[model samples]
Target chain A: MRHYTAEQIAELPSKYRAHFINSCTGFKSANLLGSISEDGITNVAIFSSVTHLGSNPPLLGFILRPTTVDRNTYENLKKTGVFTVNHVNQNFIKEAHKTSAKYDGTVSEFDKTLLNEEYLDDFKAPYVQQSRIKLGCTFENEYFIKENDCHFIIGRIQHIYVDREIQAEDGWLNLERAQTVCIDGLDGYALPQILNRFTYAQPDQPVNSIKDLGS
Target chain B: MRHYTAEQIAELPSKYRAHFINSCTGFKSANLLGSISEDGITNVAIFSSVTHLGSNPPLLGFILRPTTVDRNTYENLKKTGVFTVNHVNQNFIKEAHKTSAKYDGTVSEFDKTLLNEEYLDDFKAPYVQQSRIKLGCTFENEYFIKENDCHFIIGRIQHIYVDREIQAEDGWLNLERAQTVCIDGLDGYALPQILNRFTYAQPDQPVNSIKDLGS
Candidate 1:
């Protein structure tokens, strides 16, 4: 099958068209984010454009790319408006994919990798303590795409934590019981699993499972 | 762990706060959009907010949800501006989650699902003949996300297809060898599995993989 056109994806090459348009929109959502710096130097990075934008004021968004250089989590969420996303699993996907490496703006990818920073509740951002599904966000709005200078941002969930046996008594969670992880283009990393949950779709039926419609 | 705050997730229960804020932002790309209706009828649905907004000029976006009702893929992309995005595999995740079953706008979730409707080459939207990564897109801009009346849209990436043995010689695309499927919140689904790829992270190095730096 393999086709392409759009002038052969604009004549390929540029890190192979950024790994073919970042694995052409499929499994992305590995997290990490974290942020800190108003001299508290904390950073943490890895983000696969975290999405889920609104669950009623619970918002979430991510995209960031164009700060062109020096984007310590967009300058620590513009000097501490807080941040923290976490997730990335299969036991710390290589220190959360080496927190996207580029390091140094006063160092501190949680002191170079095997990730571990906490702060929570008083959270001025910094929470990957092994991440069994975290959150804390806040910042709240940025937009700026204009066709590609990335940015997006948008946070807001103010603290969540999880891991209560991977949630689900209706508050959902259970990312395959928190083994989370899903990225694919900017360097793989998978681990999903939950193969079915259906129920709530109708038009004349034939798609059941939410445990056979026990819902 | 199970903390929650942000005033207990804005006091839960809007369908358990949309299944706990759409499975707390982790794995979501699953697709199947299709479109085509300025009288031609074709539709196809399911979308877990397809993300990836940029890859050079290739863009992609998704969010929709607030047309109040009759959203035949947002009135056929505002009347034929084009559409198609497909991926969502494991042999069509229950006919792509039963095209999010709402039906009626002259009912056409690709003629009641198990999807099939090509059109191709002359593309005026209508592709998912059982997708293995697809594209076609065009719309090109919408935004209107005033903090939650969702619309996003974007698009552009004229035609792509993919499946030549799940790509990767450097242009990535191995979404776990195309078994695709991810969306875990408004009806779960999951599948992923790669586990490692790394290799372009730098900060004094230590991540490796991309099948051991074969770049």
Candidate 2:
């Protein structure tokens, strides 16, 4: 087995960072837009650091960079305590990726990307109408990871929209079929392919008699 | 645009959950082994919920089912607070899947599956020798999703082993080259494909002008 010294591992290129690698492949992108301004929307930003925090409370979280520089999404979320997570598919990847650009606070990404926008009920935040899945979230708590200049913005999922026909027996939607993308590194996307299926069981046991881990 | 009512969305099958869909396709199988006997060896189990939490401190997390049923991994982790996150590559998926079978505490899944094992720095937990990437993690926190009854086990990565060539320029490692797999729902794995790379920028702006989000 070949071994790299600590220095070698440390000196490994930035491409070696898991985040960058994941980013290069294409990550699930979301447009975080919220309502704050009367005549204008407060902020519209995109993020890939999002993950499912919990399903019971239907919680989700994403890392937001701190407010050293003026950030529209951060400012708007702080002011309104509400945001939208709009899923990006292959068709909208270019537009979604564009949301990472730094623009003046007055510029709206939705108008630039030509992506349609929809609003739910009385919720102030607008959802991306073109997105296959969109979630309306209320801000919960933010945990800062000091080592990295990222903040975990936890949000309770208040509303969700999913395309039909992709739902499975176990209550999960098949995202790959919906052509959703996964990210690696800074500018990559990964198209997914199904391989095989096996029963769920503890990692230490035999092959037969696989039992469900969750009741 | 077709619209589904809330009742229809709720009735959407388990397969429709985006998390399960994405998870089913990308994950490969692996054995979670523990030593239950005085032999100081290993007991094996299988899991697909293992995910990289972050890299700064090199953290990883996996879901462990609760103690309602007799699970060797759940019990062993509860007893020892130590476990291994073994990657299941194309070569060892079958054997790795076998580790999920229900086995008595006394019956070692390691004895059942055809996986070889190795150790790191005298660490009590054994790593999967067949896996391209393996890591030793110490238990940090466990959050129970009361609604779903699934336990999210967060671990601090103690050791990480990866094949060198796949590492990229920006600190992203290419798992597809490493033959990594992702899980969806209960029993599926997916192979990931690279599509394209485009710079990230805020909405409505030119992609090339956008700076790295990490910056």
Candidate 3:
């Protein structure tokens, strides 16, 4: 096992450090954050930081790098107050990954990549037509991380669109059937297959799979 | 696509709603948070919200649901001010998942689960010996989410231990090679195979795989 102290990690090259630090956290939730400017320009970027903040209010949060550069997603989200979070699947991994390419404010990634942007139910932001599961969200709040200068953008899930077949009767999503691909580090895309879904954990008895119990 | 509005989602049964909302976000990072109390009792729990907060300061964050229930992980983390984040790999995913079972405070999850605990270099926390990648972290700060009573705990990475074989020259980790798994919803564990690793995207050129460029 190789161990690195804080000092060593800080002294490493910026690019090397970025990759190491990003991957060290483990597998991240991969989502395409789609937003549009008031003037009608759409922007979608690949984000692996999307996290489930709360289930009661259906809140989700993602970390946004500092606005040192012109961040179209942050700008548009703040302006329009809404955005869409779309899951990246195996079928469109390449196209979904392409959105990470930084384009100028005038260019829409949808025009260049294989992804198609569709407006549904008059939502201000566009949703990825290829995504099997997607959420329409409105900005709830933002908090700045004093340690890193990054902003934590929290959004409330307002609308959910999922394929009927992939959803279970108990409301759990079968991501394996949906073919949603997870991200490893910055660029590695991996397909995930569901091993099993266990029931709510109890104290003493061994953990039991919901399927086995129901069967 | 089946669509659910906020109102519709709210009307769902509590357990069903939890599943629907939790799984709707996307894939989550699967990690075992190892923490020890002041009295020398160790605790390990599976966490899906471990997120890369930033690389500059090398910070990570995870959400702890309302402390309504006796959360040993949260209580121990606060008591000791240090913990370890260990990635769950295929070899020990079941062991990692079992840590989520509500064990009594006196009974360490490490003793119950198949995972072996190791105290490396006298670190306040114990590392999962089975985890190929792990981080020794110190409690930095936390923010309470108003929408839900969840607390966002932030920790600064102080030490990192990784198997040298999985570390790439570019500082990226080949998780597929490590047999690391990604979590689907609460109880589903899934292994991810690396499909492709792309280079930094450029607007002009098409997305290129790092292997193709480097090879």
Candidate 4:
């Protein structure tokens, strides 16, 4: 086992430290955030920080790095007040990752990559046609992380589009079946296989797989 | 494709809605947070919201649901000002999931589950010995998510203990090699296999896998 104190981690090469810190957090969500500028330019970028905030209100949040640099997705969403979160599946991992390249504001990632932009139900924002599962969301709020100068942007799920086959009767999504790839670090993409799904846990009772319920 | 509008989602059965909303965000990080109270009562609980905030300060944050119920992990870390984030591996998925059972403050999840707690280097928190990668962190600051009454707790990484063999020369840890599992929904566990690690993206250049670099 290798032990690294805060000083050692801080002193490491900047690029190496970024990789180490990013990967140490564990697997992150892989999604392409689709937005359209008011000028009719569509933008798509990959994000790994999307997190479920509350189910009751169907709220989700993702961390955005400081806006010191030009952020096309942020600017577009701020102007339009809506964006789409599309799952990055195994089939389009390369194209999805390509969206991360620093293209200028004038150029849309959809034009540069193989990802196609599809407008769903006049949602004002475009969705990735290749995504099996996607969400149409409206910007709700943003909180500033003073420690890191990052922004935690919150959005409310306004619409959900998913392939009917991948959803269970109980509403759980089999992401593996959807072929949604997860991010290992900044650049490592991994496909996951479902190992087990357990039932709701309770004290003093054995944890049993939901498979035991024969669902 | 099945489409669910916001109104339709809001009207869903509570359990079904929870599952639907939770899994839609994509894969989440799987970690067990270990903390001890000042009086020496230890607690461990599974968390899926752990996220990388920044690298310069080596910051990480996780969302803690509203403190309406007893939150031992939050309370203990608050008291001791220190805690540990341990990656959940394939071997201990069941044990890690069991920690979600509402174990009271008097009873430690470590005692009830198969997890063994090992104190590392005078840190106030206990690290899960079964976890291949673990970090000791101190409470840095927290922001209240007013929209949902959740707390976004930030922690500064103080100490990192990892298996050297799993890390690459670039300082990225192959989480797949560590057998670290990712959470699909609230209860599903999945093991991931790396498909490819791409190099940094650049405009006008093809996205190439790191394997092409012969690293």
Clashes of 3: 0
Highest lDDT: give the candidate number.
4
Rank list by DockQ: 4, 3, 1, 2
Full-model lDDT, candidate 2: 0.56
**Where does candidate 3 clash, by residue pair?**
none
Q: How far off is residue A182 in model 4, in Å? A: 0.5
* TM-score of chain A, every prediction, order shown: 0.32, 0.79, 0.94, 0.96
> How well is each residue in B3-90 modelled by candidate 1, as lDDT tens digits?
7888878877788889888888888888888887888888888888788877889898877875643288888888889888888888
TM-score of each: 0.34, 0.71, 0.95, 0.97
- Report the Cα lDDT for residue A131, model 1: 85
Per-residue alpha-carbon lDDT of model 1 for A1-215, expressed as tens digits? 87889998898888888888888888888888888878887888888878897888889887787564338889888777888888888987888887787776788888887788988668788888888888888787788878877767788888788877787777777797788888888788889888888778788689877762112
Q: State the TM-score of the second chain for every model.
A: 0.33, 0.75, 0.94, 0.96
Worst 10 residues of 2 chain B by lDDT: B21-30
DockQ of model 3 vs. true complex: 0.79
lDDT of each: 0.81, 0.56, 0.85, 0.90
Q: lDDT tens digits, residues A114-196, model 2? A: 66667776678777777776667777776554544455566766666666655454555565665666655456556666655
Q: For residue B21, give model 4's deviation from the true position in Å.
A: 0.5
Model 4 over residues B38-76: C-alpha lDDT tens digits? 778898889999999888999999998746323888888
